[model samples]
Target chain A: MESNTVISIQNLVKRFPVGGDFFTALKNVDLKLHKGEFTGLIGPSGSGKTTLLNIIGGLDSASEGTVRVLDQSLDNTTHNERAKLRRKYMGFIFQSYNLLPVYTVFENIELPLILNKIDQANRIKRVNQAIEWVGLTNKRNSKPNMLSGGECQRTAIARALVHEPVLVMADEPTANLDAENSHNIMRILTKLNNELDTSFVFATHDEKIMGYLKRIIRLEDGNIINDKKIKKEDV
Target chain B: MLFKIALKNLLGAKLRTFLNVFVTAISFFMIIFMTGLYDGMRQHAKQVTIDTEIAGGAYWHPLYDPMEPILFEDSHSTLPQDIRSLVEKNKAVPILVSQAAIYPNGRIMPVIMKGIDPGQNIVNMPTNTLNNNKDINIPVLIGKGMANNAKLNVGDSFTIRWLDSDGTYDADEGTVVHIMDTENFKLDIGHIWIPIKKAQEMLAMKDEVTYVSYAIGEKKVKKSDGWIHRDVNYLIQDIEAAIEADKPSIQIMFTILLSLAAMGIFNAQVLSIFRRGKEIGTLMALGMTRAKVVGLFTLEGGINAILASALTVFPFGIILWWTAKHGVPMPMDYTEMGFMIAKRLMPIYSFGLIITTTILVFSIVIIVSYLPSRRIAKMKPTDALRGKTGI
Candidate 1:
């Protein structure tokens, strides 16, 4: 693996058990993600984009082949080790804004910092900064139930980035948002990617997200069909 | 981090958490209260027996058994020189017990005739009433129970018949001089007390007694001329044994109470884990180990115990304190059932009992909480994230 590569996957295959038989989810997936890259895996449902993202995020294991994320081989790592890796270096944003419903916006954003065992003083400062970055400073004390769809997604984004992780894997982050909220969310994520030099990998099929990605990998039927890089001026 | 989340979850649960805590607090209070009642009964019974009948101890003839009234005829003997000296000094009191019958209202009723020294004050009894009475021939002292049973009040006269030392029957006219209201039923029901001289003369048993009860603070008579020395513990063993025999029933009650509380917590935990699978997935996604998740839930249960203990202090504590101050009014007198329990039973709480019950309930709560949490370890994060986990 090169020094600039954040994730290196070679012939990665994932399968699930379905009634005494194997159902292939990802077929011989070969991919490499570099630092400071804005990438998206654009595919329809059942195309195995989420499965590949889960494998790279260390949430799932490959059935065969090796997956190296941030200079560590994820093929044989224990569950605790995977959790530690995710805690220290990775962030994840789900489509439905999976913020803990019991916690306020500020507390939800502060979760990753707390999990990382960051000092209280720093946690407060970082959580406030993340809230400001997401333009949710006024709604910091509001619980998830009280927030609008855009606000909830913003809180989830702030929570994902509070620790300034090297990699952020978002699975259809704007799926539940309107076109306006989708564009707004994509702009914030793009701004964060450029400012912090963080690598972003998203599994999405929304056309609104295509304009922000510097690289797009298309998949069909558990296999990658196209890989293309676009210039920033093309948008 | 675990404590904060657990506390937040409990607070979010609102009424569910309160219900579980309330049930646990109730269990805690009931166990302590019932145990205290039993302790109070045993202590009160022992103290009364020591003050009235047993005194410090007793030296009984070898064949004497209080439970066996049929053997009373063969359980009498003359006191030794040492015991006689103690009796002369008022440090001991001699008692003569014999199987006899009384003719009351033209009916033959079996009874135990006991002779006690009227002048000796070693035991708390109304024996002095039998001394120096010219109005009645044989002045007999009976208890309220015996009076009630015989339908004879004070100053009532009846015929007393007994067997002599030579196996000859004799009869005499006896008068109930004073009916004493005492708590010790052994000295009451179906027994009559007379002056020692009159008893000896009527029974032809010259200087013979059934047992010698020594005064409180008197040294144990090492040589009693082949008599058995019965201590206070031995004398009160029947009451203790009776209380012990009834413990299992109370234990069953405790188990039911504890199980009720434990089952409530267990059900709550199961529902919480099942409902919060998405939250669990998010936590694990943000990097919490399954063990920590399990600990978080278990700590939630522990906090339930803690909150229950707090509740026990507020409302339950006041109830317990009031009961300890003013006794619990029993529906009926227990003395009639041959138990030494008083009419108004007082509860006695001990430090050891409180600590033990607290630990026992807390431990059960934690265990039940953890039992449902072990499922978290088997849950797949992907399945949980999708809210697809079965249980």
Candidate 2:
């Protein structure tokens, strides 16, 4: 564990009771995420990268373990408390872009802020800034379907960051994009991490994405096979 | 924002939305139309009671009893002079009345020929009068129905024929001094009016009246006594009892028809809910609470019912106006009373019916959407994103 550790997971275990028997999804997973880090969670299908990310993000519960983020113990909170924690401290980007199709780019970005009950004047200021941050100010009023794959992904990222959460989670964020769009999304995520000191945890299998991250955690069969940090100077 | 999303989803599948709207509209229309018809009947019945002035729990006899014929002779069933004086002495009694009959053509075709006392009958027959010169000749006030049937106008002369005590018929011609609009026409089939005094002379029955009507004041009286003056409730009960005896089959058929119409509305709403399952699911998945999803569908149901009610009101209004203006004719005879009992019972449209049906349809929609919305709301985001389960 590093001195700047923003997230710490200890002996995290998740199991599903399927057909009168227990099926383990994550086996005693342990990991640490440091501040201002661009981290990649890499694994094959059923490797439990998504499961671990979900548990750490407070989107799902671990059957056994102590997971701590921003000094809040995930194991000690109620479901509503966990949801509130997710809303305030963590933001999520899905592979499908998950932008509510009925909303324009601006409204999608403003959703999390609205849920937090931020006033209209401040909400508009923050949302406009976010739209500009994602370089989509020109397309703020456009619906998700009107945007290309790369723009939609950027909109998702803008939504994640609009509330200024301490941690941002991306689950296979580039899976639906073309190679060019994928590279563009990675660049946007990397740049935001470097400039704003926001921590990003990405669950992905893209090899090209791995090169941009300072830390890479690889899982095999729900067990961490490799955990390594690359110095920014080396990159 | 969620509402906007819901509206968009509602509009997404144009054909399905149209189907829901159409079903709602038709159900609404049928419900409204049936209600209007009921109101019209009630209005018609009320008008018949008012126009005929059949007060004190009495309706005009449906047809003259064979044992008690209402003949032009005016000698039969006449109220004696002493009885009239006895009626007037009772302070609780408001009016004591008698009528006479005349047949213009000696035939049994339904007609009204009222012969009321100029002094005693002035309250009920407020418009009765002599010709302008105040002569003793009884002026005739004809109902529109009679005037139309006989093709006679004001000041027209017509012949009256009657059966004598010897079973031979006699005839006399008279002039129609007045023609009446339908609203004022109390006679149900066809009718004519004449002065009671003259009627007695023509029928050769001295100091005798055909029938008696009395308006009793509020003082309590013996319930089962054979007084002509009776309360409205008693009158209605008598009419209902008579109708039950005479037309039981018609009553049964009307009940069945009303039940079928109600069932049609119920079935239409049920089918609408079944068809909109996916649309409801989509609304719930878009972060709408289960209550809101149910509310939207309920609102849709209420909207349909209200629209239908509004649409039905106009046509029903026209029918009511027609009934009010033109009395409905009875097929049977009511010659002695000088008017047929028009079924002038108009329907009364009320806010309560609208509110009740709205709530009923809304509840149906809410109950129908409950389980479906809950199932959709509980689905995982991944499953929903994949459009699995088609919602």
Candidate 3:
């Protein structure tokens, strides 16, 4: 219940209907994320890491829980409201990068701003700044297909930050990249976190990713097995 | 931006996109072609009747009763001497003439021979009546088909063979002074025009006439005077009514065919939407609203319709013009009705038909786009990203 807490979840449960039967994806998950915190949710396959991340990001609804982000209750928000909230306060980076292949890097970065109805001139300025921050200004006009994996991920990060959101939810963002590209993306995310004071919540199973995060929450069979915080001194 | 993305996606799958456009274009082409034929037939039917201004007291078949049909036996049906005075007294009436069909060479090739005074013939015939170039002689004008079938030219001599009321064959040979280049009222291939005196002589009739025709001063006249203005329109209506009555079943068959073509267009659009399911899902996941997506597809459909329409116009226009100029010749049997069928069919360009077809095409595209776009819009972002198929 700290004043800096950006997301708070209580007994969150998500069940998806499969073959006409309900399958539990998340079981009574509880978590708290503070502003500017670099958190990782690490779990094996079918361990509810993605379901938990989706619920927090407003991309999916929890079957039962009290989910609050930026003082807004997800349980009662309309689809539009959730969309607007996500646009204003949250950004998402998917495992596939999801950069609109038809758009240039700059346009892809400017997408979230455009969705939020930001003026074109201001969007251009913010997008350029975000590109520069991610060290991808040189490739601003390149399409996602033309860029390398690390560059694509950098564009994704630029898109995530262009709207100046408070939090970024990345679901297995590094799952499709090589080790070197993964390291580069993590470095970019860490740098953005430090410079902009933006919080990041990652759902990942990579041990290398867990070692770099300020906190790690491990899940097993849809339940959190351990929630550990690492101090700056430990790293 | 969304349009750019959609276009890029469309272009990315070059083969698939080409196939879609090809199928759509073919369907549209066939639809336009079939509809054009119908339009051409309608125009051909209208032109003969609507374009010509015939100056005569109109004659109607018995059923329509637009005019009285006077059967010419000998000279009995001829106007009484006082009838000419009566026609002349009325300033509204002009020259009066009579006409009838004579079965020549049996019933297959009936020759239309009218009993017209040379001076009165000028008023009874259409403005562009065929005349002997040499001496302005009132000779029989044969249609192209009749001329071709009988191997008779403008100067050739042919005999008119008809059975008198006494059931005897009467024959007379006259020079083919003029051949009508124009299509007749019925759009039949064969037509024969002759001077009233010569026609009476050939048919062995004395002072008989089939029906009386007189010109009115003005183009517009009230039908209340018991005499219908003898104009090209009446001729056309007479022919059309006759043909329509003759082939009532054909019109119904064409209507059904047209309706089926329309349904084919609708089905094509629906199949196109179903085929692009993944692409629609991707677009929705990109935060495009259902309305915007629908607009995009509708625009695409409009583009296709316009392109297809343009593609169809040129060939159709040329074909129609050709048919209008060089009419088709029907068999000699149909000539008895004064039918001059065009060799080529000319389509009537109707804005209503084009607009209706365009709207139908667009609506089908929209209807097809609707369910998919709505389903995509309602999809969960995570589910869309996972590439879940929309049922």
Candidate 4:
């Protein structure tokens, strides 16, 4: 593993149990993600893109190969250790904008910092800054139910960036948004990615999302078919 | 931090939280109130029995057993010099008990005849009433219960029959001089009281008595000759035993109330976990360990007890406080039940009772809360995020 590598996966295999048999999700996959890189696992549903992303995020385990994120191997770690890894160095965003519905935007953004046991003054300051970065300062005190889809997705992005984690894994982040909201969210995420120098891995098949990725790994039938790097001008 | 999250979740639940807390508060109040009432009954019964019948303590004849009325004939003995000295000094009162019957209104009713010194003021019984009606064949002091049963009022005459020490039956016309009302049913129901001298002359049991009762707070003496000195606690065993026998029903009630409250909390926790699987998964995703998640839910449940305790301060607490201050009026007369219960029973809420009740209810809430929350430990974060039910 290089010092710049945020995630290193070697021949990773993940399986789920079917009736008296096993259904493989990711098959003998090899991948490496570096710091400050904007990458996406581009695939349709059931192409194992989400499975690979979950393995790298330490939310799920590999059955056969080693997955190391930020110098820690996921295979040997306990559930509590995995939680600590996510708590200290990783953030997550879901397509559904999984911000806790009962919490206000500021509270949702402050959750990671709270889990990190940051002091109250620091938490408030960082949460306010993240809210500003997402252009949601006016809606910071509004709960998710009160926010538009775009605003809710912005809050999720703010939460994923509030702790300045080394890695952020987003799955179908813009699946539920319109083209305008999708672009707006991608723009905010791209700005935060550059500003924070955070590594980002997105699993999505959306063309709008693909345009924003500097590197794209395409998967088909649980296997990677192409891995390519592109410049912003090429899109 | 955990407390803050738990409280937020509970408050966010709104009506569900209120309903659980209300049930818990009701259980808490009912337990304390019922226990306090029982305590009041015990204390009142003990105190009144001591004041009216047992006094401070007594010296009982070796053969005396209050439950065995057949032994009353053989349970009498001439007082020892030491006890006689106490009676002479007005520090004690001697009583002779015998099994007898009364004929009133053409009814043959059995009874117990007690002989006490008319001038003795050691006990609260109105024995001085026997001193009146010197011209009557026998001026007897009957309690309200005996008088009511015999249909004999003051100055009414009835035929009393009893066996003498020689085993010969004798009869006399007894006039009721007074009907005294007392809480101690042992000294009231189906009992007749006559002056010791007249009773001794009539029964041919000269200078012999059953037991001697010392004045209230009198120093207890060691056993003299064949006599047994019974302490106040020993003498009050019947009342205590009666109360102890009735405790199981109260215990069953407590179990039901506590179960209802616990069940409410348990159901709420189950529903919270089931409905908020995504939220739980999200929390785990953000780095909360499953144990912490369980603690969070358990704390939510435990907070019901805290909130219930706070809720108890309104209505429940006020009602308890008012009842403590000015006794609860019993629905019916309990004098005939022979239990020395006051008309308005005062509740005694001891410090120990309150502390024990709080800890008990709090622990139950925590346990029920934790029982359902344990499912979080077995849940796969991915499955939870997909809104899959673990239980």
Candidate 5:
């Protein structure tokens, strides 16, 4: 357990029961992520990238292995403890930009702070900062139904970062976005990661998205075939 | 904060919330109306009986049984002096009842002959009509119901034949002097009233009366030997038993109303659990526990009922207020049906009735709201996140 290691997975195995026999999603997968690392689980579909990402995000548990997030043992922690851990230290960005359809952009951004039970004054301040960071302050009153894909994804990013979590997990964040909006979203994530020193792990197979990552962990058929740090010159 | 979130959700699902709340509010208004109607009818009937028949209380002979009109010939005992003194002071009346046969327009019908003091003002009866200051034939008082049944009007003559104390049959011609409308069927159907002395002589039961009904003026009457002192409640016991007997029928009405309301809410909640899987998963992913999600949905459903209550209270209030102030005329004449109900009954609503109805409707709505939400607790956040659960 290094001081900088926020996520540590060892011999992690995840199996889903298909009919009667089990289908292995991840087999003895091992990974470690440090503070401020912009990493991507680069793999094709059914390659266990999302499965590993879910285990690291504390949304799912390893079937037969040890996993740690923010130095807390994931296998031993209760669901409530994991929820609290997610609330206090983790942020998530789904591929579909799962913004609450009824709430305004401002309200969606304020949701995480509300969940953390932060006082109104502090919540307003943080929400305003997050909204500005995503450049959606002008559209703060717009509900998700009226927002464009780019705006929705940006609002999703603001919601994820509003509480200033220690880690952010994104799953196919650019899947529904145009190439331009995809790059725009990637740039925002990169800026937030660099400026806030918050670690990020994105499960994306898009090469364009992978180009923005500082490290790429290529997974193939439930195994990590390649793990390497990208050089600034690689971009 | 939880309430605010729930309020927001309820407000968001406009149609679903509206239908459930409307149904719930319908149940609320119905229960209140029904109980109030029953209560109002009972209260009015009881008061009418007190005014016309049983004033405050009555003293009945131990052997007297009003239900068995045939036994009235043997049921009378001498009125107690305490009651006789009250009658002398115009605070009581000695009533003698006998069974007789009447022939009107060649139509022979059974009648329960009643005797009352023509001068008594203690009861609300129009017995003064029995005076018939200058009439030659025996004057009698009949209720509108009996007059209608017998086709007898004022000044119309009929023959009444009955057995005397010696078991001999006697016939007399009686002229109807007045026809009164009373709420009590006992005084209306097949009943005729004559002067107490005339009835006593006709029945050959001299110095004996069936019972002495008196107005004691809030003072309790002491039970005397050979007499049964019936209080106000005891006097209305038959009515209470009638209402009590109708309670299960009333309960069925409530059950149907509540069940329909519950079914509406249940349908909405089941749909919500299935349709809002992604939203629920998002909330769970945003650090809301499965319990909180259930609470939020349940609270939302409860708020639906409360909102419906708010929306309906004013409209229903006006309706109840109108019914209470004016009255609701019966669709059919209840008097002819042989039931004791006023022609136009003014509904009486009580604070307890409204509150109890609200509590019951809200309780049922909340319980209906929660059962479907329990399924939310079993959904896995990951599967719900993908909108793949509860399909």
Candidate 6:
């Protein structure tokens, strides 16, 4: 284990049973994420990027490999321990900006903090701050149905970051948004990652999302074919 | 936070939430209302009997079985000195009961004849009508139920035939001096009332009575060899037992209404799981345990019960209050059907009834809500995140 490594994966393999046979989703995948890095698992639809993201996020168990997240081994942790790990150290964003439709934007952002059992006065203060961070202050009381695509995506970002998790995993977070909303979301996400010194990992196929990544791991089918770092001045 | 979210969800789907809560509220209201109404009827029946047939207590001839009219011919004794003293004080009424056939409109109708004193206030009856000064004809009082059945009216004349103590058949014509209405059908159905002395002369059994009915304040009826002391509670025991026997059926009816309410809540819970799959998965991904998700859904369902209680208390309470204050009228004469019910009933809502109903309904809502939410524990977060429903 490296001192600064927050996520380390080695010889990882995930197999699913289909029609009494096995379909491998990831094979001998090796990856490492250091602190404060903005990274993307870049791949096409069948490239197993989301599968690896799900595994690293503790949403799925690894079948035949070692994976460690935030210094906790994914292979040995119990289901509840994995849940606690996610609650304390990880946050997730999804493709469709899955904000609870019945909840207001402020409430959606407050959910993670509430799950952590933060006190009411501080919870309200943090929620308002997160609302400002996502630039949805004017739309704080609006529900998901009342918000535009960019606003909804901003609310999802606010929800994911409200608890100040060490690692944020987003699976195609801007898939449903137009190009303008997509760029706006990436700018806020990048600014948060740089300013807070938090690690970010995204699973995406979009060229636009790839533009913001400092490190890109390219996946072909079930294998990682290329890993590269982009300098800030290169863009 | 979970409760707030649950409440917001319920408020969001306004119509679905309302239908479930309305059905449950109605069940809650009706369950308490029906039981209270039935209890009220029982109470009314006991009170009316206390006022009419059993005034505190009575002394009955040991051989007298009110059911067996054949034994009434021998179920009598000469009045004792203590009983005579009570009669003098107007605290006891000696009734000589005999079975007779009346010729009314040329149709023979068998009836029970009770002779009560005109001046005695031991029981509530229209026996005062026996004071009519019609010397040529024996004046008798009849209830409206009997009058309706026999087509007899006040001032009408009829022939009554009875067998005297010597086993001789005697016949005479009597005039109907009053037609009274009462709450106790046992006092009215197939019965007629006349003066005790006139009954003694008519039956040729002087100074003999079937039973000595003590007034409201009378006690210490001396036990004779042929009479038994029956307490007031013992006199009304049959009615109390009959009312007790009807309770299980009433519970079953309320259980059914509660089931309807439970089913409504259960259906809503199931639909919520199916419809809100994405929301559930999002919560799971946001670090909520599956149990907490289940708790959130169950809490939502429980909120329905609380809301239903809030929604129903005032309106149903108003109806119950109005019914209690001003008795609710029955479409038909209840006492006439021999049900021991009054024409108007004031429902008695006991504290026990309301508490039990609330507990039963709230418990069912919680259980049914949790039943459907259990599927969340079995749901794979990845699939749920994709908005899939097990398929």
lDDT over C-alpha atoms for residue B231 of model 4: 85
Tens-place lDDT per residue, model 3, A128-194, is: 8999888997898888889988888888888888887898989888998999888888988998899
lDDT of 1 at B296: 87
Give the best candidate by lDDT.
1
Candidate 5 TM-score versus the reference: 0.89
lDDT of each: 0.88, 0.61, 0.64, 0.87, 0.85, 0.85
On lDDT, the stronger of 2 and 3 is 3
Give me the displacement of residue B222 in model 5, in angstroms: 8.5
Off by over 4 Å in 4: A205-208, A226-228, B1-23, B61-68, B74-90, B117-121, B126-157, B165-168, B173-183, B195-198, B204-208, B220-228, B238-264, B298-316, B333-344
lDDT against true structure, model 1: 0.88
**After superposing the true interface residues, what Cα RMSD does each candidate give?**
1.2, 5.9, 3.9, 1.1, 1.2, 1.6
Report the poorest 10 consecutive residues by lDDT, candidate 5 chain B: B216-225
* Native-to-model Cα distance after best TM-score fit, residue B272 in candidate 2, in Å: 12
Q: All models, DockQ values?
A: 0.58, 0.09, 0.28, 0.59, 0.55, 0.58
Model 4 residue B254 lDDT score: 66
lDDT tens digits, residue span B289-317, model 4: 88998898888888888999999878799
Q: What lDDT tens digits, residue by residue, belong to model 2 across residues B1-391?
A: 4444345444543464555555544444444444544545444444455434544433122222213434333334434344455335532112212222344444345444456554543134444444352542457667666766666677766666545434555566677776654443444235566666665566555544444444433233334123243346654454456445645554454445434544555455555454445434333322334445555555554554554444445554465446445634445443324432333433444566456544654454444444444454355433444455442
Instruction: Indicate whether candidate 3 or candidate 5 has the larger DockQ.
Output: 5
lDDT of 6 by residue, B1-391 (tens): 7886688788877787888788778878877787788778889998999998899688887878888999999998887777667777878888999999899989999999988888777788878778865574678888778888899999898999988889999999988899888888898889988898899999998988999889876777664555777788889888888778977977787778677766766676577667788888888888888787888888987898899898767788888889888888988875556666788998998889889889988998888778767686558788788878763
Which prediction has more favorable DockQ, 3 or 6? Answer: 6
lDDT of 2 by residue, A138-202 (tens): 99999888999899999999988988888888999999998888888888888889888899999
How high is the TM-score of chain A in each model? 0.99, 0.96, 0.96, 0.98, 0.99, 0.98
User: After TM-score superposition, what is the CA distance of residue B17 in candidate 6 from its true location, in Å?
Assistant: 5.3
Cα misplacement distance, residue B348 of candidate 5 (Å):
4.3
* TM match of model 1 to true structure: 0.84
> What tens digits encode model 1's per-residue C-alpha lDDT throughout A30-143?
989899999999999999999999999888899998999999999999889999999999999999989888789998999899888899999999999999999998999899
Query: Among all windows of ten consecutive residues in candidate 4 chain A, which has the lowest summed lDDT?
Result: A53-62
DockQ of 5: 0.55
